[model samples]
Target: MQARQDATARAVENADNLARVIEHDITYTSQLTDLSIQAAVDGAQDADVMRLPDHLRRELLFDRSATASQYIGSLLCLDSRGKIIVDSTSVVPRSVNLADRTWFTVHRDNPKLGLFVSRPLQSRLNPGEVDLMFSRRVNHPDGSFAGVVVAAFRLDYFQNLLSGVKLGPGGNITLLQDDGHVILRYPNDGTPVDENFSGRKNFERFRQTHETSFLGTSGKDGKERLYNFRRFDKLKMIVIIAPAARYVFADWTSRAWYIGIVTALLIVGMLFAAQLLSVEFRHRLVVEQQLRDMTRIDGLTGLSNRRSLDDRLMLEWHRAKRSGKPLALLFVDIDRFKRYNDTYGHQAGDDALTAVAQAIARNSQRPGDIAARFGGEEFVVVLPETDGAAAAVVAAAIHAAVRGLAIEHNGSEHGVITVSIGVACTDTEEVTDALGLIKVADQAVYRAKASGRNQTSMAEPFGGAAVTT
Candidate 1:
């Protein structure tokens, strides 16, 4: 049984690690692919290389694919003026301005070879419109500077590449522009070109970063998405990969029969082991709870002890600080505990104290308040998110409750057992630590005892005292 539990734990850990590994592997692969494509695009960013003219380039590369066996790999074409032309008769974008073509740049000003890629044009000349254009400069047969030469590539190659890779179940990959337009998606959901999430927050952020990824809710189905992105300079596009956790986990359930059989055998062993563990766990839990109870509770009055008082004070002090509200601490002491305990057999004295503790607890009606036994006949109550006036009213209730308890001690001078209460409130300024707040409340307690017994005394956070004794 023990071994089975260990095996189950190990399996869970292994599965979690494997999920992370898979995520990391796909993220890295996407990053590398993006870099390679960008490198190809950057090679063409050179203005001088793009200066090649179309007419001269067509002449140089005219049917070169026929003579050179392979794909003419990349043909560089040039015009008479040595400038590259980007005019395409096909794929006329309705809203797009042709003057913005990258290939028409002043490449001569920065003469350097560049690798480039251009989207497909809708024309019979560009039968498969997606074109990969590589541009470079060289001298002509006459030794004069030749026009820029561009090698046109078909888009079919990339369409195949995007679909070929093995991304896990529900794993998605897309290429978009830094300007927020998504160029393409794998496992096509058929989102239109312009109507998609072009102006979303992600697109706005894309320009500020070269790469980005996050665990977020998917924009498509509102499901959890682990999104990874890489920016490609060659095409001036950002590539994003997203994997859904729910769909990924669902695959394991599809093979539930096999998993269930194994789990059944494991469960039998776990039950036996759990019995042994539960025995030890329960015993320890009981002892720990007893110790905790003792620490917080008063020995004589059966009320919350000094430790609880300190803890409550700390909580209330911090709460008041954060919210700009106020917290109140009330300290209560038996008017004559030592004398009463000495005169009455400590038994009767203990009874009187217990009565007061119960009364204080009963009177602390607010949900945001605590009444605790501080020590040796002394007690404290904490009120959180409160103001000075609120505290004073609570303090008065505590005083009244103690008197109403009607527990009589023949030795006491008063008709029955009674308490002197001190109220200190603060919106939390000047106190350096939680302990400082307690000290201020204790000072109020002292003043209440000084004024008289069976009454209440209130003080400003750090100032004048008012007595109701």
Candidate 2:
């Protein structure tokens, strides 16, 4: 009963943390998009890009493109009548009318709205690909509506932001309009998935707890997930980070297997000893088993400690060499964690660390995947038979899981807790020792931390430079 209660509490806490992390990231990105579109409007006004002749509009767009790197698609300036006046990607003067578009209509109807975000739609220019538009109302000097200035960012832009986060085969992250229209889902399977939860109880639940997280089942995939409903009011959307329940409890499942085997062995030993040995001998055997278990687990996080990880890594390393398969190692560190400890006190810091460890464990789904608390705020994962690309997928999942924790951190630039991950993998012939693999992974971790926190970096097998993702 105590174990069950503890597990429930941890699940609830993890759900809340994941919601906060998604909210923070979506809010931050929305603010950036708002700023980007606003800047484009200001730039258009300053450069007279809107009023320039059609022949020269292309030139203006070229100049603008040279200086900006924010938008993944293109920028557009539309006339009050809905005719395209300037397009950044268009070389020929194309006659496209975007007057019927929601983004354009919303701004035309409500000029007071600083920015308008559209639901995911098929791109008019980039056909077959979905796009989300960020638009701002462009006004004349006299405050009359001139047109709409749009920054059409491809849906892939948002997808790439989460490309690294893989939650096993069933894990998914979704972005939805506040109205519950599905905008994006990761692991693009090529089938058009209309996962809109609008008009359903789940959508209603989202409206009720826009700032919090709750447990729910996904209507699209039919998986019970820890759901977070975070609204970016400015962007008119909500981001949901939902890892399937099975994946979330994977570590617990692994521990259960270990416990079950040990219990069975102990039972058999006791039965045999009942006929042939003394009672004190059976008690001593039980005590020895308990001691062995203690040595392998980290008390605070309930994860394998460094000692366990070392043993597991050595075993996996030899197995990989014998099978001629790849062995992957990931070194994870909470970014700006010292400042978090200083601000939140050690107890809160410990809680944060525990949460981080749990996130790592949840994402390391394979039975052979070893997640260990490697002292303080650092954690490690040993991925047997996993190549660099596959390890990167795990790394992304770990990043997403930790970011989901969203513990408050006043000192970090992100204003919330985040993690940096370093991934290193070796084919059988690349390294003769596990220590060399650890060194490579450790170097990648430093690179990830140094470049920026909340990102993943990978090291080449043969000690090449660390590459940030």
Candidate 3:
């Protein structure tokens, strides 16, 4: 009896650990794909972006995809009319209209929806290939609906990610959205991906806890199994690991028949299995740490990426709104950056960008402050509980730091690397949401650039005149 109990406990522990590892991997992939989509949304906001030459527009909207090509199948920007405006895979937009698609209609009808993950479906661009889309709503400066930015992930990529796990005999792994729709299942059981399991007793029990292990009967195969499941904190997804109960106790059952003769051998075998599990668990912990770092940090500048910035912005926005405090944003752009890149090589341009990023990071020293590389030649700083006056001071400090670098850029009128900064604060009623604050700040940057390239500009109330600092 004791041996059977030990076997069952080990199986449960293994399943729980494996489920955690798989959950972290899936979450990281989803966030990375969403980041790419957000970048496209940001680029799409420029009304003239779609009018640029095809290659130039594609590079601006889809440059992030190059870093994550293994997971993202394609990045696309669709117009408000649901016509393909920009596609990452080709220079010319495809003749595809997604106006009738559910994903498109959901964002069009709901302006507040942030990111939406869709069920697997056949790809219109790549016939016969299945894709799962990660999408975000794009909005015009006045907060009107613009379009949708999509990152399509090939289903086979997920299959390969989960296929390496050695779930023992009759074991299975399932990935489901929070709504109980199955996204993927291991062993390719021929079950449809969209099958709804929310009505099942097993799924209801799994949803009862954030992380847990139990023994249950498989709804599909009708076999008793040890089930371990976990749900993500912020992501709308759950992971389940189940291995047949008979297989879990097979060794213990055999040992019980010969307890008098092979008792010592059984003890040694159990110890060996326990040691293997410990090693595997430690290895997975290391992998999870690496994945977490990759998801939050930008590869080029070593600062918080757009994904991290978006999360922190929303968090601070809500906190300030509740506390009746102010939040500030700075839009910093390198002056004459394209001219610098044309004069020097791309390597020199990269060095200049890194130097400018460091300058911005130095001035944003508060605990609640964050500086992130928004995209090429641009950066954003979030200052929680800060007013317009204080934000302008920080922007001035950033301008000074960049001048201190003294990086020579003969392409500029100033003969040195300089930055144009746009500052905006949520002290006025004009800014209703986090995205609105960003728009105001971005507009201020444009004003700064237009007035002259090397000064600070503060945003007036939305639609009001620009204020020079």
Candidate 4:
């Protein structure tokens, strides 16, 4: 399928080159037409050419010396034909009728040759008058009517012009009539074609896009030549044709099966390489993220470990120190965990630790606060921007929350897991060292155990001042 598309694309390219060649020919012809008519119009605008005798019109038209040195030669005239005025050395005349034409109208209406333009065509000639019409009109200085100017090729110009142009090697370009009739062709397919084969079953591809197409056979010689065709809207349907296999690019596409195969393989290889690289990268990233998470998490309980809690305490301590705000720390431990483990199995002890860790995590109120299992049955919390008073309230809440747990603790004194909490508050002076705050909070936890288990206790803000209950 790709090979087929490649062939089609090559055919289109061949057609495009053909169109350009034709367009170049048209442009050269149009420019020549314009220059010649301007010369004639200059003569008509002159008092000499305008007022000269009809016999003297030729002398004035062709008399370059009569004008300044800047003027080029004028359009040459010939043909002893009476009604069909003939021209020599210029464009191909393809249409019939000249006098009542638009060129004549615009020539009469507009004085500037630059204003209006037309395409070349056959001239309608009659016997007696030897008349001719023009492809374009030129204007007089005062906007009055000027005469028509037609091309008079030097000699067999169309034949010579078509023959001289070089299409790409393996590519052959040709000119045609609107009906798909060959007017000019490379490799010289001299057979004349019908001028009415347009918009038909035979030439549907060419009709659609003015594009190049490959037909099976030209049928004239039944030879296989790639067919690229174009039709001119301005010329009432003149067509230009070119064949593939003569142009250089056509040769490249001749091996399209091989070329397309290489390109497809390269694309597939690149995609597979990209897929492999992405899979490897994703696998590495997943493992790396798990490693990072494990460093901060307790293995037995899914809580932030002690290493993370130490970092969190220092962070809150520094924040309180700079802002002159307060920081609070809570020290938590499962009441009589060692006794419970001795009485029950280590598995039961593990269950008690998990329940205690959950209770502490649930009690942390703010997102900025830290809740971590600080090794064994001990847990710690860091509360930022909180004073001694606020910390006490939070500590009380945690104490109450743990006591209310309905965990089935067969070895616990309270019939379930409970934690004793020690709250310590710090001011800027005491926050100088985060470890100092942890030590005081730990000492408070010892006080809670000494006074009575399963209760909340607090330490001084900075100095060893007596804490109010």
Candidate 2 clashing pairs? 18-404, 164-396
* Window of ten residues with lowest summed lDDT in model 3: 460-469
Tens-digit per-residue lDDT, 1-469, candidate 3: 8898899889888887887777778778777787788888988998788678889999998888776648688888988999988989888888999988778999999999998888887888889887888889999999988999988888887789887887778888888888998888897788788788898878888776543778889877799888888786667777788888888988987788788558778788888999999999999999998888789888888889999999999999999989999899999999999999999989999999998998899899889899998899989999998998898889889989999999998989999999999888896556889998888888888888888778888876545655464
How many residue pairs clash in model 1? 28
Compared with the true structure, what per-residue lDDT tens digits does model 4 show for residues 170-259?
A: 445555545565444455545332234445443656666554455545544444555655655544335445453434345455577577
Give candidate 4 regions above 4 Å deviation.
1-246, 254-261, 407-416, 462-469
For candidate 1, the per-residue lDDT at 463 reads 76
Question: Model 1 off-target regions past 4 Å?
Answer: 1-269, 410-413, 427-433
**Candidate number that wins on lDDT, 1 or 2:** 2
TM-score of each: 0.41, 0.49, 0.53, 0.50
State the C-alpha lDDT per candidate: 0.59, 0.76, 0.86, 0.61
Task: Write the number of the candidate with greater TM-score, choosing between 2 and 4.
Answer: 4
Who is ahead in TM-score, 2 or 3? 3
Q: Is candidate 1 or candidate 3 better by lDDT?
A: 3
